[model samples]
Target: MTVNQQILLDNRPTGEAVESNFKLVQSPLPTLEDGQVLVRHHFLSLDPYMRGRMNESKSYAVPQPLGEVMLGGTVGEVVESRHPKYQAGDKVVGMGGWQEYSAVDANVPGALRKVDTTHVPLSYYLGAVGMPGVTAWYGLVKIINPKAGETVVISAATGAVGSAFVALAKARGCRVVGIAGGPEKCSYAVSELGFDACIDYREHTDVKTMAKALKDACPDGIDGYFENVGGYIFDAVLLRTNAFARIALCGMIAGYDGQPMPLANPALILVNRLKLEGFIVSEHMEVWADALTELGTLVATGKLRPRESISQGIASAPAAFLGLLKGKNFGKQLVKLI
Candidate 1:
């Protein structure tokens, strides 16, 4: 029997998460039943949404149960399989959580899918060519619906989802402006990611100041906004949005710390005649195939360049996740479990 190392949620955080909240333990894997496969995880995705799952309050998905495996997306190889569809050495992506190995039921819908790593890296399945990529596609194509030559602004611009949006919007002929935490990220957004301009949010003292910077950066006014950080960033964007502007609300990392960070200007939404919609990507599974196809092609062809900030092992996941919450990660955050 193979020993499976697992990270369990030891306790829910009241405010910010710490390493103490997670407990790593090891257990022997059970014999596989028919229609089951044993997977040895190679990479684990650490996303901002995982913070919400730690809360005990009601959320879009169920609160992750205490003492269970810390929920996450993982890519791995099948070591043993009783299922006819899967064979040993097959690489697959699934919700394998924060563990070294998982015994997954092959019959479950959307539980696992084979991945081709010959062209694209296996880690891309957790970020650019995977869930985050599809998320950016859904928000951009379905909600924002940006037309050619329009101005698009995105926050957390160098992050997993936001980086994908930059590429997607730029490809559609939109002039993109990015709002990031520092000079390095802002520089990357403009220099490496093909953004028209980028504003360093840390350079401003308040929303009013940031709004002025956004106004100057977007002289044509903002036509479409992709919101990731919600507090002051949302307020600044509200001040510069053009009439009939659309905002795709992807995430509010600013409010994840249990702080009261409300939007400062609801009246702007009315005055600007903006259409703002918040979304959860997992609920829309129909578009995954198309999104992945396009995203995969972009990455493989070097059109879409998604970056990663990877930590070494499962034990490092908690600190890495906390660092991500603190805006320390440069791009998509992942744990290299193998």
Candidate 2:
């Protein structure tokens, strides 16, 4: 492709992100250097983390620069390559951002890597067998560390990371109870994702009701927790947490749009002696290979079937992403660039 269509962060969000915050632009695809590769991206990953990057405020990572392609993971074909390690038609994954093509300096380690699609689908590299999968694995295996027969709870249970977390936790013999927004997602968590039970947060709008639902679903008490959405749902989980329970503080989507989401009961941490830890999966890259191995096998063997909500083209990214923040997208959201 000679021209690259791109999404640029036009401005930071005031509160909730809107389409106007992003601008669609066209530019000549960058000319590749001798050690660079030109990749034609087929799929671009849309994730909740991108919301945090939209703000100019300090965060776990730097804010995405204005008038540049919005950053994201992508999988595509290598249409042209001048690097010795890569060649034309090679299927690869990289941080190709929000664009149809990327001129990558392949010599930069981890910027580009070939993927095998023999058993696993290429898109799965963006969700279940990729970053989301590794996020689930690290939190459960490294942080929570639940034992067999213990009950573990996850919020945003049907989401990309939550679905993977459920599968991985189930494999370790933990009773996984999921918390999702609506009845549909709750049912899917149990019937499809194999959660022991799933509490619909819609019905239980407050802490008491949600805590009661947790009490019923996890009769044994929550021994581990993988948190995504915070706010009252997290408060309810805290009320049901067992002594010395481990908790992985992942995404707090409930507060992502500049909302206040403070813990209702901070004393519970001391009362329950909770071991809560927040992490960035990228910082702990050492476990990626091992995590991807198990996650790939799960997807390849039909053990972990991840759902996806794919938008048709790059132009749809802003709207699709806005929908994702509103919980409209079911699972891993992507923009199909091809």
Top lDDT prediction, candidate number: 2
- lDDT per residue (tens digit) for residues 117-164 in model 2: 999989989999989999999999999998999999998888899889
* lDDT per residue (tens digit) for residues 97-177 in model 1: 999999899999999999999989999999999999999999999999999999999888899988899889988999999
Instruction: Please give the TM-score that candidate 1 achieves against the real structure.
Output: 0.98
Candidate 2: global Cα-lDDT? Answer: 0.92
Candidate 2 backbone collisions, by pair: none
Model 2 segments more than 4 A misplaced: none
lDDT (Cα, 0-100) at 135 in candidate 2: 97
**Which 10 consecutive residues of model 2 have the lowest summed lDDT?**
254-263
Name the 10 consecutive residues with the lowest summed lDDT in model 1. 254-263
